[model samples]
Target: MAFFGFKDFDRLSEVDLNIYRFFTANVDKVPYLRVRDIAREAHVSNSSVMRFIHKLGYDSFPEFKVSFRAEQQQAHPTNHQINFVTDQNFPTDIYEKIELVADRMQQADQVIFCAMGSSGALAEYAARQAAAVGFNAICVKDPFYPLVNQLKNTSDNLLIALSVSGKTIELLELLNNFINNEDVTLVAITAEPSSQVALMSRYVLGYSVPQQRIAKYYDLTTQVPALYLTEQLISTARRLAVQAGDHLI
Candidate 1:
């Protein structure tokens, strides 16, 4: 069910990309868009829309929508767990925390790893590990529109967002959008379960760590736990892939 190195869409022409943009922008409006409607939105002819769909590996518009939904489901599975970290002190039991994080990663289809400041570094590391193991993983940051568009094209992509305070505005907005979309799966890694990010996420992975503020630099104290969690997730995903004979690149 993996879509690794699939280049069918990479060769798309400018016209085709434009058509994709139009459909993406109006995904909510047209759950199952008609050929005429797509043409109207993209300012193209019916024939062109049909041709574009064909190029995108779809026999017909209806068939395409069905496949799209299936893909989404495959990319995002529902089995998951949430951990709430409320301790103001460092994690004393490393093995237990790692096991918990790994357990959560084992259940997700794909990890949409995200974080702010130092936490962002951890998110990137986790995403790379998932991608390396042949999982459909992505790292999302401040400019989230592109990531959102990419998610729309795939199925079953799980979001793993990390924030210490669980109150990052950018991360909150992104989580809010996904919360409204029943098709997406969200996992928030934060220090507080009562924070905004946790409230919006379907699953919350909380860790206890000290919070620190800086006038001109990113907070590092709150980021250590996030990094540890990210590593655990990456390790767990790799182990699962190995057991399933789906070793990633």
Candidate 2:
């Protein structure tokens, strides 16, 4: 069995704790960040930051970052949860769900997939699927700005958002801006059934997962299950389009 102890982290001083928090929060934004950046952000000297990393069991700053990312990846493996699909299941429900996703695709002339952090990968995957079917599909990295621009003069378009918590500030802000816009359709896929995203979207698809018991742990169950659902939706859309003699590129 493998385990990690937080006693060392708990022993850190206030300044070190602040530095660690900064590193964790900005790691995704600055994956290859420099030690000087961390020191500057933490208001500490480079030497002190190096000492801190060493005390945290890292040989160097880069080594510390690598270990930190590895720890995160291990904590949230790509396939963290299992999805069961039995042959005995009814095809009508599956077909209905597929038709719902397919109908959304057929109605939209353009599509934008938006998400951040780990969920961004799912958004990108959805975008690619739509593009393959000859839809004007684009993946917007900066959610707020792109969404605001698109909503101003909305087309036959749809915004598909993938968010695990559904409370991300950027996404929430975008959703709030579009709440009164009837020209655009908003679809949200989230793990939280009662999340603000679920409540605000015109169409909400929930991905249920068992809650984690541990604190401060990355739970792939929160976001990864959506991958399966997204894939199913995309496949169904494509197959339906092909059946209708609508040659998608």
Candidate 3:
């Protein structure tokens, strides 16, 4: 919601940026936290909190918190927790979802795994796993010269994109080109189904894990959910391929 429809972040002072980072990092607790609570945790003054609130056009923290929580609730109506060991909210129909993705992979002329940074390594692993299962899979390591864009003859393609936040600018830009492509069946594995990339996907595997950051910009979210999802997808697709061949025989 563009930071809950607040756009004055760029106007914040250098010191204010600290408060901004803390606020974003702890957004799940924002509406419940008192202004003094925020001030203490963010290591800022009460007046600085007031200034930050005012800069975002809220007359007071209560007013801002209400709006923030409302926007968050409206965007995400369901819990996204995917911790297999502890997340009771883990998707109940996950196997069904994996089957659908497997169908897409089995039908594809080629499969592409798209991601960057930490997720990029996972993408490479997924690509190799898919290849081992006999699918023509490749990972796009560099967005500038992606093999997905260069392929000409393949009409049916399956794209598996992974991102913890699903807000990566480069990945979003790359997806912009495939939003309307009838030939591409996109499966977005990300932290939130409401994220920009997930919105563009034909199928989505969303998981809720804690987002951790280093230096306020580097993402350290756990990739276990993504890894598990890809492994399940490849396994299902391989089995489906064999069954379909048997039926043909």
Per-model TM against the reference: 0.55, 0.58, 0.63
Clashes of each: 11, 0, 0
After TM-score superposition, the amount by which residue 206's alpha carbon in candidate 1 deviates from its true location, in angstroms, is: 1.1
- What ranking emerges by TM-score with the best candidate at the front? 3, 2, 1
Q: Write the per-residue lDDT of candidate 2 for residues 1-249, one digit (tens) a residue.
A: 111233566657777777777766775644467888778877888887787777787676777766777766776667644445332222335456556766887667778888876788778888988787687888865764656765577666777788878777778887677677776678877877589997888776666665453454454555556776677777777777777787786
* lDDT by residue for model 1 (26-142), tens: 644555777898888788889888887788766677877776666555655567545434344334564565455555566656668877766777787878877876777778766
What tens digits encode model 3's per-residue C-alpha lDDT throughout 64-145? 8888888788877777764454444247777788899888888888899999889999999999888876888999867685
- Which should have the higher TM-score, number 1 or number 2? 2
Model 3: weakest 10-residue lDDT segment is: 81-90
Best by lDDT: 3
Q: Where is model 3 more than 4 Å wrong at Cα?
A: 1-89, 246-249
Query: For model 2, what is the C-alpha lDDT against the true structure?
Result: 0.70
Provide the clash count, candidate 2: 0
Evaluated at residue 90, the lDDT of candidate 2 is 24
**TM-score for candidate 1:** 0.55
